[model samples]
Every structure is written in C-alpha cells, then in structure tokens.
Target: MTTYVINLDLPGAVQSRHLYGHFAEHLGRCIYGGFWVGEDSDIPNERGIRSDVVEALRALNIPNLRWPGGCFADEYHWKDGIGPREQRPRMVNTHWGNVEENNHFGTHEFMDLVELLGTDAYVNGNVGSGTVREMSEWVEYLTRDGDSPMVRLRKENGREQPWKVPYWGIGNEAWGCGGNMTAQAYADLARQYATFLRDHGDNKLYRIAAGANVDDFGWTEALMKSVGCVGCNSSGVASPYQAISLHYYTMSAEWENKGKATVFTDDEYYATMANAWHINTLLKRHTTIMDHYDPCKTIGLVLDEWGTWWQVEEGTNPGFLYQQNTMRDALVASVHFDIFGKYADRLFMANIAQTVNVLQAMILTDPDTGALVLTPTYHVFEMNTAHHDAHVLDVVAKDAPVSRKIGDKKLPALSASASTKDNSALISLSNLDLDHARTITLDLRGREVTGVTARILTAPDVRDHNTPDAPDAVAPREWTEISRVDGGLQVELPAHSYVTVSLDLA
Candidate 1:
C-alpha cells in the first residue's frame, strides 16, 4: 500500500482553465471530413461544421482553441481563404500534404466553431511565407470594429459583429517549417510583425512569440529580449503579455520509428513515459531562463503544441498526421496536465497537438460513414475538467514500490495532482504500473472529504482503444473503489488507469 498527504492548508498555483486548451489545424481530414462536412452531408452539421464533433468539444467545456495551421499557418495566406467559397483560390498545402488545398473552411468557419464551443480563440499569424502587412491586416479583419476597409469588408462577408480573440501566436516553429530562421532572426521578425499587429476595441490580444523547439533555451532567452510587442513600451510602462510559446510531443525518441500507437510493449511504454516526464526538466530549465529575463515571472509559457505523436494509421496519408489514441495517450495527457497545473502561475495555457482525427486526438472520425468515436484521451480530459480554475493543493505521495524500466530509464509507478475550489476539490490520479493494482491511503490533513465520486479510465489491456465500430470499448466507468474512513480515503486504483476524484469540501 502507498500513502499520500494532501495538505489542504497549503495552496499552490491556481490552475488556469486555459491549460485545458485544444488545437485544430488545416491538415488532412481535420478540417474537411473531420470537423467540417458541408451542409449537404448526412452526418448532421451546423452550417458546415460537424454537429457531433461540436457537441463533444462543448462537453469538455474547452477554455480556448488555436486555429489555422501548425506549419500550415505560415504558408497560409488569409486573403486566399476569404471572399467567396467558390471564388477562393486553390493552392497546394506544401507544408502538410503537398496536395491541392480547398479554401472552404477558413477564418469565419473557425471562429464559428469557437463560438459554438463557447471558447476563446487563439489565432496564429503567418510570418514565414507571408508579409507583415498580411498578418497586420488579418488581425484588423477579425478585431477592428471601426469603419475601416477591412472591417467593412468583414461585415460585407456576413459577420456583422467582430469576434473576440485574446490569444495570438506570432508564428509557429520559426526554427523549422516556419522559415527555418535563426533564434535572433526569428526574434527580429517577431518584433517587426507584432509591432503593426494592433489591438482593436476591447479585444486585448495576448501575443505569444514562437517558442523554442525543445530545450532550446537560447531561443527562449532571445525571444524574451526582443518580443517587445505586449509588455511596456520603448520607455517601459506595462498591460503585459510577457508570453512565449513551447512545443513538445511524446515520440519513440525517433520520429522515423515512432513505433505503433495501439501496439507497444512494456519496454516501449516505459521509454515513452520517460520522455513525457522529460517535460519536467524542460519546464525547470525554461522557467529558470525566464526568471533571468523577467524575474517576476510576468512572461507566461504557452505550450501551444503537445500530445503524443505516433506513426500514421495504416493506409492513411502520411501528411494527414492521423494516429490512434490509446491508453498510453490518456496516461501521458494526465501526467502533462498534472505538470501544467503545478506550474499554472507561469504555465498559463497549453493546447494538445491536434484536436480531432489527428495526433493524439480526443475524437476520431471515420471517413466512409462519417462516424465519431471518443478516444481514451477524450475520457481523461472529460473527467478532469473539474480541476479547471481550481487552486492546486500541495500533495506529497509515496511511490509504489514496483519499478518499471526501458533501457536505462525508469519512472515513478504512480503520479497524482490535486486542486480545490470553493467548497469543492478535484484529485486526479494515475497508476503507471503495467500490471498489479495499488491500494492508496489519501490523507487530507485539514479538510473534510465528502460527497466523493470518481470516474476512472482504464481497460483490460493498455493498448485497448475505441474504434468507430466499438466506440464504448474503452470509456470511463463510475469508480466505486473509494471509501471514506475518518480523516482519510482509501482507494484501490486499477493499474494503467487515470482517475479523477471529486469531493465536496467541508
């Protein structure tokens, strides 16, 4: 048996609800058949967007969504996507498929999806293959309420009201697909582009500079120094963004041999998890770097791109980036979210790589039937939403004695995080043991835990995943393995599971 202490008296960073953010890109079926099926399709859609996908996203109560492109954003010309659907120009998605791209689902459709999901919008601007005037005008089109040419053109296109977009990324991966610029080079471009990126009306933009690839502390240092768009002035006055971005993915150490998503040995699982735990080191190093530049921690770390990146599904387009979401993905997400919650003060926001039909998606769609099935990762996010906006509770847990390793690496057999709100508390727990269940005694030192309820996501096999034909094959089940006893709660956590326990604080 393992024991843990939840010190209710000691408060941690307030878990930013935006930490549960999602990303949507224009690659593969993510836009066309994934989330957008024209009004004529039988899959039940709202003005073109798939109804089922919309409902699933709404259920998660997502706080924010990033749009346009991953690498596609840089190559994407916003002007080419608007005006008239049929009149819109067709071009090749060179960054993604190198296939012909349609301009049907553009800016308006994305904002509509955000409105339908009741979430804020985080728009990434084009800085790689686009000019400064192009991105500046794009922001003007979406935000400006004045009677300018762009605003008038926007109203003429149909939307009478300007959409609110608080978050904006100056670019994506400037070190790589985003023009392959050097750290200093990208920093100079970020400042130039952000200079003309104006804030219209009350929609205050949170400009995020393209962040370091992974462990590129120099990029962080350079961006912090040059990104003078959000905070202060030439004289230093301050409303403050101080925000920069970061991107990380859980791969098999090598992308060429990413291993199978739904079929992996315990050895592969251990390696993947060890890589996920590597985020802790990245955060510590990056934040340490941030402290040097902005000691007060005013600058936020935006993990805009994350989640598992496995090989493409069999027979799927390689450029499409379609992959299966398995039990391992659910575990990885829980661990990442736990880390994000712990550093919520500086880690203001994060978005999983791709939302649907893409890397580690919450929902998977079938092309033939247009069917939608929630993945194990979906259930984990669905169950963990209670911790949104709650202050994290400082927890100290005893690790399970059993240890699992792959090659030269090993990870804690158990992981957990806790948070509390007004009269409510949420505790998310994960058991990384490939086999063998662990009994845990949770001692809430100074708070009463009542009205306890839990939903656990686990399966008979760690690789078990849901297909369109078996959508319910692996879903959350009401967990009755918990019971209150005096000052503590006893929990029998199933192996390879992610459980979120909700308790009414008294």
Candidate 2:
C-alpha cells in the first residue's frame, strides 16, 4: 500500500492557468482541416474556424493559444498572411510538407480564433529569415492604437481596433531549425529583436527569448548572461525578456527512430515512462542556473513546446507528424502535469505541442468524413483542469511500490499531485504498474472532514484508444471505490490508470 501524506494547510505557489496551455502549428491537419475548414465548408463553423474543435477545447478552459509555427515561425512572413485571401501570396511551407500555403489563415484569422475561444495569444515572431522592421511592424500592427503606419495598415486590411497580445516569443528554436546559430550568437540576436518588440498603448508584451534545447546548459547560461538580471540594485529595471523557453519531448526510443505511437512492447512502454520522468532533472538544473543569475525568481521559465514524439503513421506525409494517441500518452501527460505542479513557482506557462490532429494531439479529425475523436490524452487534461489556478498542496508518498528497471534507469510505479481552490481540493493520481492494482491511503492533514467525489480514465489495455466510430472507447467514468477513512480517504488505483478526486471541503 502507498500512503500520500498531503499537507492541506501548507499551500505553495498558485498553479498558473497558463500552465495548462496548448500549442498549434501550421503542420499536417492541425490548421487546415482540424481548426479551419473555410467559412463556406459544409462542416458547422464560425467564419472559417471549426466550431466543434473550438467548443471541445473551450471545455478544457484553454488559457492561451500559441500560433504561426514551431519551425515555420522563424521563416514565416506576416505580410503574406494579411489583406484579402484571394490576393494573399502563396508560399511553399518548406519546413512542413513542402505543401504550398495559400495564406488564407493569417494574422487576422488567428486573432479571430483566439477571440472565439476566449484565450490569450502567444505569437512567435520571425527572426531567422526576417528583418527587424518586419517584426516591429507586426507588433505595431496588432497592438498599437492611434495614428501609425502599421495601425493604418491594420485598419486598411479589416480590423479597426488593436488586439491585445500579452505574450510574444522572440523566435522559435534558434539553435536548430530556427537558425543554426551558436548560443552567444542567438542571445545577441534575441536582445536586438526584443528591443523593437515594444509595448504600444496599454498592452505590455511579455517577451520570451528562445532558450536551450534539452540539457543544453551552456545555451541557457549564455541567454541568462545576455537577458537575466544578476546582482542588480532594487532600483534596477527588469530584464528585457520576461522568460526563457525550454523544449523537451518524451520519446520511447532514439530520435532517428522514435518507435511507434500505438505499437510497442512492455520494454518500450517502460522506456517512455522513464523518459517522461527525466523532465524533473532538466527543470531542476535549469532552475538552478536561472537562480544564480536572477535570485529573486522574477523571470519565468516557459516550456513552450513539449509532448510525446513518435514516428509518423505509415502511408502518411512523414513531415506532417501525425501519430496515434493511446493510454500510454495519457499516463505521460499525467506525469508531466504532476511535475509541473511541483515547479509552478518558476514555471509560468507550458504548451503541449500541436493541440489537434498532430503529434500527441488532443483531438483527431478525419479528412474524408470530417469526423472528430478525442484522444486519451485529452481526458487527462479534462480530468486535471481543476488544478488550473489552484494552490499546490505538498504530497509525500510513503511505502510506494519499488521502481522497475528499464535499461539503465528506474521507472517509478506511481505519480501524484494535489491542489486546492476555494473550499474544494483536487487530487490526481496515476498508477504506472502494468499488472496489479495498488491500494493508496490519502492521509489528509490541516483540514477537517469533507465530501469526496472521484472520476477515473482507464482502459483494459494500455494500447486502447478512440476512433471516430468509438470515441469513448477509453474515456473517463465515475469511480465509486473511494471511501472516507480514519484521517482522510482510501481508494484502489487500477493498473495503468489516471484518477482525479474532487473534495468538498469543510
């Protein structure tokens, strides 16, 4: 039996709603068919944007949406996406599938999508192949008010009022796809670009510099030296960039061959879980380095791109990055969120890569029939939504199951986290054991007796997933095994399951 001693009175950092954010790039069906299907399409839509996808994502309480590109952001020219759709120039998406982009879903369309979803915007700027004037004008075009060249252009295009853009990324991945520049070189460029990304009117931009690839401490250190504030007086001004980003993806195997999405053996499954656990180390090390530069923890850490990366489905466009999401993916998400809750103080925001129909997507859309199916990973987010903007509760596990060895690393059989808001509290648990069910004791402290309700997401097999015909094949259902105990509560967590218990506090 595993015992989780949760300290309800000792509340830590507030879990920022942006921490549960999502990402969508111009890749595969994520944009063209998944979110936008043209205003005239037969599918129910609101001015070219898919209504079903928006409604489904709205249920998750999506706080923010990052647009334009991952790699495509660096090469994207904002001008091509503006003005009339018929007159907008067509460009080949060199980073994606070599498919020609008609520029129909440009800046205005993305802003409209953000408005409809009632979420904030995190737009990535072009730096690798774009000029300084272009980025400056784009910011001016979207945020500035009163008389200005960019403002006039924005009005000429269509919109008369300026849109609010709170968060802006200086560039995507500068060390690799964005540009093959060295750490120092990219840091210099980041500083220059951040200078021109001005705050117009009442809108102040939270500039995020392109940070390190996984475990690239040198890159992080260099970025800190350039943008981080160290040993400064209290009178000193804040850093030009408010946060630095880090990108890490969980994979079952090597980058060259990242195994399959849904077809894998037990060894591969353990390997994937082991990989997911590695993010803790990455966060700790990066936070330590950031602490050295900015001891106050004023600047934030943004994990802007992260999720499972598996090989593309056979017979599909390899560059499209379309893969299946299974129970394994759901477990991976649960573990990530558990860790994110632990580091909420420094970790301000995180966006899972490609929210729909691409790479660990929440929803998959069929091209032929226009059918939409929610993936198992989607249920994990929906189950854990209560953690958003809630205060983190310290949970210590005792007498937990012994870790299993996978290759050189040990994969823990359990993952958990808890948070509280108003008079209610939420506890999320994931049992990674593939065979036997584990009984868990919740030793609640610093609070009186309360009512508890729980729901669980699980399937008979770890490979179980949802198809358009069977969307609820692996969905959440009411969990009734939970009961009040001596000091708190006790529940049985099945093998490879994700559970969330909601408490009505006294």
Candidate 3:
C-alpha cells in the first residue's frame, strides 16, 4: 500500500481558480462552429454563442479564458473582428488551418461569451503583427471607461460598459510564431507596447510578457533581465510584469510522428508521463531564475499555453489540431494541476490549449448534429474544482512501487496533490500503472475525517473515449468503497485513472 500523510496545518498558496482555466482560439472550428453557431442557426444558441457548450463550461467553474489566438493571437487584428458582423471584414487565419475567418466572433462576441460563462478574460494582445497604436486602441476600445473616441466607438458597437480584463498577454510565443525576434528585441518592443497599453479606471491590467517556450532557460533569463521587470514602476522600483508567460505541451516525440492520441505503445505511454513530469523540472529552474532577477516574488509564471498536442484526428484538417483525449490525457492533466497547485505562489495562472474541438479539449461538439460529449480531460477538471481557492496542503507520500523509466527519468506510477478550505479538504490522485490497482493510505494528520466522497474516471480500456452517441463510455462514477480507516482513509485507485476525494474535516 502506498502511504501519504496529509499535513493540513501547513498553509500554502491559495490555488487560483485560473489554474483550471480554458483556452479558445480561432483555429479550425474552435470559434466559428465550435462555440459560435449564430443566434439564427438551428443549433440552440444565445446571441451567437452555443448554449450547451456554455453550460458545460459553466459546470466546470472555469476561472479564466484566453481567446482569439494561439499562434492566431499575434496575427490577429482586433479591428477586423469588431463593428458590424457583415461590415466587419473577413480575414485569413494564416496561423491555424489557413481557413477564411469571418469576423462574426470578434471582441464583443468574445466578451459576451465570457460574461455568459462568468469567467475572467485573459486577452492575448496583438503585439507581433499589430502596431503600438492598434494594441493601445484595442485596450482603450474595450477598457476605456469614459466617452473617449474608443469608448464612443465601443458604445456605438453595442457594449456601453468596459470589461475588466485583468490579465493581458503582451504577445504569445514571441520567440516563435508570435514573432521570430531575439529575446532582447522582444523585450524592447514589449516595453514600448506596454507603455501604450494603458489602464482605465478600476480595470487595472496585469500585463504578461511572452516567456520561454519550455526549457528555454536562456529565454526566461533574457526576458527577465532585458525587460528588467516589465511594466516596471518608475523611480527605479521593480514590479516587472505581473506574470511571465510559459508554454509547454505533453508529447511523445517529434511533431510529425508524435504518437496518436489514442494509439500508443506502453513505452510511449510511460515516456509521455516522463515528459509530463518535466513540468516540475522546468518550473523549479524557471522559478529559481526569476528569483535571481526579481527576488520580491511579485512576478508570477503564467503557463498560458499547455496541454497535449498530437496528430489531428483522421480526415480533419492537419492545421485544425483536433486530437482525441483518453485516460492518458486525464493523467497528464492531473500531474500538471498538482504541480500548479504546489507552486501556486509563483505560478499565477494556466490555460489549457483549447477548450473545445481542439487539442486536449473538454467538449467535443458535433458540428452537423450539434451533439456534444465531455472528454476525459473534462471530468478531471470537474472533479478537481474543489481545489480552487483552497490552500494547498503539503502531502508526503511514498512513491508507487511500479516505476517505469523513460530515458534517464523514472516516471512514478502515482501522482497526487492536496488542498483545504474551511472544514473541507480536496485530495486528487492519479495512478499511471496500466495493470495494477494500488491502494492509497492517507494519514489525515489528526483532523477529523467526518465524511468522505470520491469520484473516479477510469475506463475498462485506457484508450476508451466518448463518442457523440456514447458519452458515458468513459465518464466519472462515484467511488463507493471509500470509508473511514484507522490511520486515515484507504481507497483503491484503479490503474490508469484519476480520482478526487473530498473530506469533511472537523
């Protein structure tokens, strides 16, 4: 039996709900058909957003949403998507799929969707392809409170009040698609753009600079040093950026031959876990460097773009980036969320790559039928929402007996994290073993474990996924066997599964 002692007395960072955030990009059907069917369409929608998808997202209690682009963000011109839907000019989405993007789902539409979902907006500003005035005006247009030209234009466009977009990404992947500028160059440009990206009234913006793309320690160092505390306070004080953005995705190997989402060998599965574990390493090294530059810990690390990226589903546009999610994706997400919670102090926020109809998405909407199914990744998010706003508790546990080596790394069979709020505690665990059911023994650390509830998402087959017709084929089921035990609570975690147990502590 694997043993873990939950230390509820030690208070840790309050896990930001934004860590359970989602991403929506203009790629493929992510926006046009996935989220927007138009009010006129047969698909049930309010305004232009899909009602059912909104409901599903609401159920997950999504904290924040990053929109309009992934690579699309940099090339995106906010003007092209505003004004009148018909009068709003269409543009080619040169980034994802190169399809014709009708400006139907512009800034207003996105904010409306955000309001409907009741989540914060993390707007990825157009810095690469857009001019300083353009980025400045977009922020002004959405956030300016008074009757300025931009505000007047916004009132004319339909939105009278401003949206409190607390988080703003300076650029995305500036080292890559956002723009191939050297780190020093991007830093200079970031300062210029941020100077013009003003704040209006109570809608203070938390500017995020495009940070390193996974293990690029040099890029992180360069941005921190060169930017020298982006949006830094004058008088030689240091506030830098509220956060530095980081992007990483779980993958088996090269992009071209990255193992298929649902079809992979045992070695590939364990290897992917090792790769997922790399997030731990990256966070520590990056945080260490950030401490060196900004010791105050005012600067946070925003993992804005993260999730599994693999070959698009068969027959789908290669650029569309629609991949399948199964037990593998769920376990990967569990590990990532645990890490994010453990480092909530330095890790401010994170957003999964795509929320729907894209890589590691939550909902799969059938465009023709409008039927939807929640992916395994969706259930994982739903199960762990209790961690939001709860103080993370340090849990010491012995490694699972089964350890698989991928290259120089030994991937643990089980991963876990714990958090507490008031009289309740949330413990989430993932078992990566393919064939062994491991029993986890938890030491409640002297707290009264009055009530216990558990939810498990594990299928008979690790590759099992939900189709539009068979949505429950791989969904969560109540774990009925969880009960009070001597040391604490002992529960059976099925191999290759993710589980969340809520405890009512006295």
Candidate 3 residue-wise lDDT, 158-220, digit = tens: 888988888888988999999998888988887777777888888888988999999889888
Which candidate would rank higher by TM-score, 2 or 3? 2
lDDT of each: 0.86, 0.92, 0.86
Q: Highest lDDT: give the candidate number.
A: 2
The model with the greater lDDT, 1 or 3, is: 3
Q: Work out the TM-score per prediction.
A: 0.96, 0.98, 0.97
- Per-residue lDDT tens digits for candidate 1, residues 1-506, read 88888987677788999999999998988888888898889889999999989999999999999988789999899988787899999989897878898898889988888898899999998988889899889889999896899999899899888889888889899999999999999888887777788889998888888899888998998887663333334555442344889998887668778888988888888788888877888888888887666666768999999999998988999999999988899899998987887687789999998898999899989998778999988988898888889899977866545556666666778888999888888888889888879888888887766688988889999899999788987899899999887678898999898888888877
For model 2, the run of ten residues with the poorest summed lDDT? 227-236
| TM accuracy, model 2 | 0.98
> Which numbered prediction scores highest in TM-score against the true structure?
2
Model 3: pairs clashing at backbone N, Cα or C within 3 Å: 69-73, 229-240
